[model samples]
Target: MTEGETPAQVGASSVDIKDVDVIAPNFKKRLSGVTSTIVQLVPYQMKLGIRIATLGPGLPAYLPHIRWTGLFGLWRPPVGRRHRIWHARRNNEMLAGLILKYVLSMPLKLIFTSAAQRHHSSYTRWLIRRMDAVAATNSRSGGFLQVEHTVIRHGVDLDLFHPPQAQDDTIAATGLPGTLLVGCFGRVRHQKGTDLFVKAMIELLPQYPDWTAVISGRITPENKGFADSLKAGIAKAGLERRIVFLGEVDDIRPWYRRLDLYVAPSRNEGFGLTPLEAMASQTAVVASDAGAYAEMIVEGETGACVPAGDYGALRDAICTYLAAPSLAALHGKAGLRHARDTFALENEARSLNRLYEALIG
Candidate 1:
């Protein structure tokens, strides 16, 4: 199966189920960071001529994916290959792969990608120990793993997210009210430090009338009150007009390109990708040292980094960029160069492909 080949089409066609080279499983319905990574990477891998297909649900129907019923087909050896690589990102997926390889006696080489920045649970550790190979998203995440693993940092699609050719026109098209736009994106929740970004903005936006802040993401039902409280604070500060919350835009690349500066105030993350995405868009970043953010940003050159949950440091960093617009431009250009040179999506896909080949060989 390839992109645009639906499950129905796959069923109707003469495509052989035994030819899949890799299986990337989702398992969960909600769109999570892991799902996003799989969605972004699989297409590139397919273009590279890797026979990859996503399993499980919640992904776009158009993505190259096999039906859940395809699990039985794993019992047979893939044509021209001794075994298929089952790449699992979550414990449940690892467990399923284990069952297929062990109980069903399928010829599958199980590989796992670990992105969690903290210690794993006992069960997860056990599952990790059983994997044929493990890949961590960063050096810090590798430190948390009990087993030996390779560090493969995530990358962004540079073509989809590039420097804006016309900055003023891009901002105007967003319909956001500001000559200078600073954006904080991700889920609107306390753990993500959305409140901290709001607090920092409340203090800074009032002083700089030319600057406005935008928070774009989904606020889940449980976090409705938290979002409302932040809105209330903005109202109380009398800067409601200065700050805007454009809840979860489908295309966030433009939001990144239009920003004068981008903030990733996550208190916790599993290898945060927002800062890299922002840098790919040629936007300078001010991010907390969460996930692999400290590793991603070249402080003072690309962007600044602060201690997680330290709103004072965050405010100071944002203030420095706001005070010196020239500095922000320099950082943005440097960040763009850094991202393009180091973090292209093809680099990541090729690295993973090599690793997959080594395991299978």
Candidate 2:
């Protein structure tokens, strides 16, 4: 199955129960980072002969999946294999794996991937302890894990995000104001540091009239007031036309290519991917030291990293590019090379397949 296939055409029934070697469970209903990871990686893993299938709802039809009723078939091992690997990324999925392996006495090996940098709760620790294997999305996540785990950082789809054919043409297509564009994308909330980016732009954009700042992300109902306040601040700064809010975009790849610089001022993250995505788009980045931002960036080469939540540092970082846009192009070239050689999705898929194969063996 591939993109744009209908559910009827790529239904779970089409995939044989005996062929599945790994079950990647996504218990969440809403779209999230975890869901995005599964959607992006599964097709690659399948191409690499991992025989993995998702076991949950809310996923796209392009993925190989097992229906909820298919859980009954777990009583029998897949083909000649002794057991299947149950890979979980959430607490509830971990519980489901535990029940499948222990409660039901199924032929399964449980593996959990952790991305949180914070220490685990007792309940979460309990789940990790019972897993047959664990993987962390980054070094910081591994540090927070109680069990031994492999550090397999997430990777970006290079095909989806690459350097623009013509930077000026891409920027013109956006129809946004200004010759140079800097962007901060994600949820518009305090934790994401949307206000910090806004405040920094409010202070910097007037001085550097050649640049425009763009923010693109979802604004939930609860955070409407927060988004409103930021807009109010932009209005008060008299830079409303200069600093624009793009809300949530359908495809952010073109937007990344349009950018001369990208700022990811997130106060916190569970292995942020925007910096790498920007790098893949041949755009330089200025990101806070959150999630795997530090791990991904080459620091001063691809871009710069500052202490998370530091407005002074963020403003200074953006000002560096605004003062000398040529520097952004230089760094952006380096960023594209780094992203291609280091953070390609194929690398991540192979690393994960090795781990899954080892567990199955």
Candidate 3:
């Protein structure tokens, strides 16, 4: 606690634990400024550490010692920043946060992933400049930050998220061999701009033949109304013929394989993963300009990225590519190349390894 500063912000999530699977709601409830999230992989933290350390003590040299949590304690915030705030929205990097406050207080160099978080908060806007380096998951992420950190594109298991081994093979059940199928994956929320994706397709389907949109995602039980609303929109748009809702699936490969394009119309993001999954599946993408779209998409090179909430722009992008399948294929190939070059797991681990060594030094 800093001098004259109030206690931790109300609703702020706990900063103590790095285990994503066990994140507590009370943590965020206690700190107003913190946003809590679960990444689903913390139970394996200690096991992974032992494995890494076994590979050689060198492995943990740069990375945080598996037991550092006990030393640092939890949720340590700035001492004098009278109004320390948080903007937590995470899918995979919860562990990074455990050391964030400590990082802020030090002069050490660091690689900040999840750099493409979308926010207009004055506090967040101010903090971006204070970062030493950014670890942008996509080019669009790099662009929005207005600073070039490292271009570490998001990763995917190419071997797993690919099309049928034979590109020309008939996947009759999917109707993808002869038909152009465009898929949209991830959460089904208005903020994801599901309404806008449907509207864009509704307007474009009249001109495009042999094309359809497949949306796959989990509808929160509390947000069942949101899913229902999307269904209603699809019906109103008369796209009951052109759109397919697969709901949530435990494995996404089958869904990824039967697609020609992956579209994400999120109004905001640090980096949306579905499009990357699409790219990994050798499918082209058309995403919103918000977040990392600018960095990941090369306009006409890899995939198309358009501004969020703009139905016209969004529709035009989908149409332009749908009319030319080769263009889409080319972009998909580029995306795969880019992912392999920078975002591979080995590269991230290597970078993380260095980061840990530096931290402990």
Candidate 4:
């Protein structure tokens, strides 16, 4: 359902079994109870609960079963019938809710993966207020509320994302070796600003011959052509040696380790995780002058913040950093400190745990 729809209109039935005897205290653990039995147990079930229950054996029967789940006061009336709002933009909308579900779902006590799901129109707000609480993935998201919300920082795994004292193994994979590595890494998609970065790199490389552009990440089949286009631009500008497209790698920490700088120039964001990761690795960053970057970057104290798609400005910003390696080092160290204090895995986990406890309590 679209974010603009009402609870019932969006599929949130006003018929939540108000007297639920068995509420899954923890959303993560309760998620496992995907059975018809779950619906039967709820004294007063919500349509959302019914959706969760009917996944296994109920799936075969539940599609048709939902038609009759909301009859007039059936004693056990559709025990777990829920009207849940399910939204996706092009099937893979990158919202705060979606990111939280993917990144922290395993350890989470609750799940709410809808980017700006809460930022619906006034009509939608009436529907959303029915929920007990709203969980926002970041301050940018959480602060925007018609009601109460809990802000939880999304994070990376410290164990697997180990930074190296030496350069990462990813350099060999990136193929832009022996040069000053100024890189961008993530899912090689439009939102990451691959096009803008490529343009910036091309404009800057003539003067800074040794500087490299390492675009690392997977180019989905739909966007592989975009990657090709980037390659063509690199060639046309005679920047083949300066730009490297490491299609996709299993581990990317090495790429971060090898980088002289990391850049994220997205046009918009709820919170950008890549810069935090780069900072955690003691790498300097040049992120877009858009949402959440202000929370994470300093003009030149922690990292540089460049405009989203301005190649000329990005090139100049890169030059500013390149001109002073010591300054970059100082900013990188500051960024690392900020990331640790604000976005580290432990800090995130603790913040999440508090949210869960509040939810359960």
Instruction: Tell me the whole-model lDDT of each prediction, alpha carbons only.
Output: 0.87, 0.89, 0.55, 0.56
Model 1 alpha-carbon drift over 4 Å, by segment: 1-15, 166-169
Q: Model 4: per-residue lDDT, tens digit, 1-361?
A: 4422223223332224333211221112221212212332221123223222211123222121222232222234233333222111111222322343335341112233223523666644544454445656557666566777667655543433445464344455555645567888766667778888888888777777667778887777898888888899889987787788877776567788777688887776656667877887778898886556656776777888877777677767777876776777788788777777776555544554444345443
What ranking emerges by TM-score with the best candidate at the front? 2, 1, 4, 3
- Model 3 poorest 10 in a row by lDDT: 51-60
What would the TM-score be for candidate 4 when compared with the true structure?
0.65
Error of 3 at 29 (Å): 16
TM-score: which candidate is best? Answer: 2
Task: Rank all candidate structures by their lDDT, best first, as comma-separated numbers.
Answer: 2, 1, 4, 3
Candidate 2: tens digits of C-alpha lDDT, residues 1-361: 5543333234433366678899999998888999989887787787687888888888876678888888899989998799999999999999999999999999999999999999899999999999999999999999999788999989988867889887443666777777888989998999999999999998888888888889999999999999999999999888888889998888787889999999999999999889999999999999999999999999899999999999999889989999999999999999999999999988999999889889777
- Candidate whose lDDT is highest: 2
lDDT of 1 by residue, 119-228 (tens): 89999999999999999999999999989999998999776678887744267776667778899999999999999999999888878877889999999999999999
**Judged by TM-score relative to the true structure, which candidate is superior, 2 or 3?**
2
**Which residue pairs does candidate 1 place in steric collision?**
none
Regions more than 4 Å wrong, model 2: 1-14, 166-169
Higher-scoring candidate on TM-score, 1 or 4: 1
Q: Estimate each model's TM-score.
A: 0.94, 0.95, 0.63, 0.65
Q: Write the per-residue lDDT of candidate 3 for residues 14-97, one digit (tens) a residue.
A: 233232211111123221111211111111222234112111121212222223343242343223222122212332223343
What range of 10 consecutive residues in model 2 has the weakest lDDT sum?
4-13
Q: Return the lDDT, model 2, position 157.
A: 82
